[model samples]
Target: MTPISQLSPRLLWQFFDTLCSIPHPSGHEAALRQWIADWAVERGLDVMQDAVGNLIIRKAASAGMEKRKGVILQAHMDMVPQANADTDHNFTTDPIQPYIDGDWVRARGTTLGADNGIGLSACMAVLADDKVQHGPLEVLLTIDEESGMTGAFGLAPGLLQGDILLNTDSEQDGDVYMGCAGGVDANITLPYEAEPVPAGHQALRLTITGLRGGHSGINIHQGRASANKLLAELLMDISQHAELRLSELDGGTLRNAIAREASALLTLPADAMDTLSALLERRQQQYRCEFAGIDDFIRLELAPATMPARVMSTSLQQRLSDALLACPHGVMEMSRSMDGVVQSSTNLGVIGTRPEHIHVQCLIRSLNDEGRNRVAEMTAAVFRLAGARCNFDGAYPGWQPDPDSAVMQLLLDTHKELFDVLPEVKVIHAGLECGLFKAVYPGWDMVSFGPTIQGAHSPDERVHIEAVSRFWQLLVRVLKQIPER
Candidate 1:
């Protein structure tokens, strides 16, 4: 896979390359959706779009497999748009530039979109390649999966005729997932009043960066440092040692991703402004030691910045600082049944200082409704106690595990036959559309698996090359070995 264009599974790479050349970030997948719809029609397959822009394509079963169970190939069409701070790229207009890096395919200073793009490409390949044996097939491509799960939530009942759904949006290759976490978004707001900066005060820009921020749900238990949480803690500490007044505060981009960097603009007494250098230096050293092998390059620094006209009132600044510091930002609980698996967690993903009120965003993930709600309640209480209003939205149900699943057993046996090693079955912590699909297709049996992907929802995102070959091989065989109805 030195050059992704020349990779094995020729048809899959062909469609993936086309996807790379199209800009299809969350909520902006019209161009890609239309192109895919036309491609399906040109191939003489039945294609249609649902009310919320989900693209569905149906292909007849092979001659001998017509009596087998109908299988649905599912993947989200939209991708999380995240780029490096200095990278000059636009998710809405610019094509993703992917190149082979050793055994992986990575994008240039941006997320590679392999989270579901590769999965979607596989669906197209299965439709075009007649040799890939399958039963009655239906491909479901959902939109806005990254920012929100609008597409999955809006998917209507009785639209699909499939009895078994094979979700291809999972990241790791060696793991077959049967259940996944559900999630809710915590939107927070705190009203504040602006006041004139005190006399003889200077502004400084404090930055926390160089942390490896991974996907909030998948990597929540990895002990990675959150830049937003770090910044909030530092601000609270500085207030105790000096007269700190906040002018602007902001960090992170998407709620589904852990914060990689955060910055604060504040005014301190000019005479005491020199105090931040040593403080930042001390904190940086401590943080590095604390996160030693994890966030290897975590950093904290302060620089002189232009003076601001006004700052948040003393009371508001204190409240915001306290609230941010008190908010939850890591794994809250671990699964007792599964060793080392995260059961519930939260990411303090974003913060912004608007004109009138400060906005804060969080994402909570859990394997059950009670688990997620319990964490959400704890988080909401922290913000509410600090005089902020919080509301939970985008609540989706978790996928339940089925021990007696015939489709799952068939997939497992097929994988073992192909690789001589059984894939690890898991109930993952990440939120996938299969959970929401349960609401619409209550009787459909679902299982999710995909090629190995690393650092998803972040600029360091990349997909394994050899693993893709194995993933494709397994999919091809599984389709051929589908159990008869």
Candidate 2:
């Protein structure tokens, strides 16, 4: 029960603790935005809300530093809301309960919001302190970054007057991110007509749990299982041996997250129950062997359940199963230039049964336009051919790298001076808001860096204690040395 404010770099942690007290999950940042706006006004700083609810807070330069280049500190205000299935937590109304583990800060039964929360906190600390020397400073806090790039897309040009933008959203304290992948969301809906359950049918619930589902982009190359895709495969296989009808299905909640759990209600002939159960057991063993070291805790089970009055039509059931199996999941291509980097990937993020039809969500990520388009096209084709309507939504461009950037050199030199070791420059597979910024502000010289965070977009998310201290130190140095315009 250690107080988060007592952690090293008290100012940043103090701000983070306050953020945790406010529920700011994706698409619900109004409360947090109001709190920040009022706080800035109290300090006599200039703040304004954009058309899309993005906050732009401005503070004048420190004494004798007005001649330096203007810098914009950027981060998202929303966090992915994820909690353990058994935990009784409500993200919309409940404050995140964070506690200290050995060397990290974790939340009880939910995500810690460390992906962009920690970065945004550093901005708060700087804005409140007049002692930190910097040029004319601006903080751009965007909304709905976890679910969609709503704020980034709606950002109008001629708003931010900064020469450079310092993005604090990337994980890994030392690795400097100059570029990131673009992505498109594939929203598929398949129509279904439920038929009354056959007289000879019996119902059972099949569940798959215990997979270490991390961020769909950051952890795509690790070969961890996707619960939605896995459950689809299991249902399809078991159906071949018996007359199986799907009653209900759901797995994974967010389209941008790797699915960690899935479940389905199925109806089959009572006599064929033992055979289907046996087949499920066999497939579970095969899955364990495939994802052996990566997802060692994978579990597949079936239990007796009350019989439902109706089930999906056999045609719709088969088509849904066929589409899910054919849908692309995991790394599709590797970067030729960067060793061990994913060039293109797609995650079968979520699948669920709604009132009228079944819907599927898949997120495609790629460094190049061609790669991203190719995967999006492929994902759409799979669902379309299976008698479902598909859409390509939230399509954002990739952030191309600037190897010769002056801002990058300033950061690298600052790091070399402080830590004695140069930080590695990288282009991550994850979707960052920097790419969207290019559409409005093309002249921005941006470099993204932050404290080490692991298991983002999952309930196991945590931020490193020591890395936050170094992250703050590096940021403070970079702010002071932004080049003269």
lDDT of 2 at 67: 88
Q: For residues 364-449, what per-residue lDDT tens digits would candidate 2 score against the true structure?
A: 99998999999999988889899999988899999999988889999999999999999999999999999999878999998899
lDDT of each: 0.91, 0.92
Q: List all candidate RMSDs to the true structure.
A: 1.3, 1.3
Candidate 1, residues 206-292, lDDT tens digits: the string is: 889898898999988899999999998899889989998999999999999999999999999977766777888889999999999
lDDT of 1 at 190: 92
TM-score of each: 0.98, 0.98
Of candidate 2, the 10-residue stretch with the lowest lDDT total is 1-10
For candidate 2, what's the RMSD? 1.3
What would the TM-score be for candidate 1 when compared with the true structure? 0.98
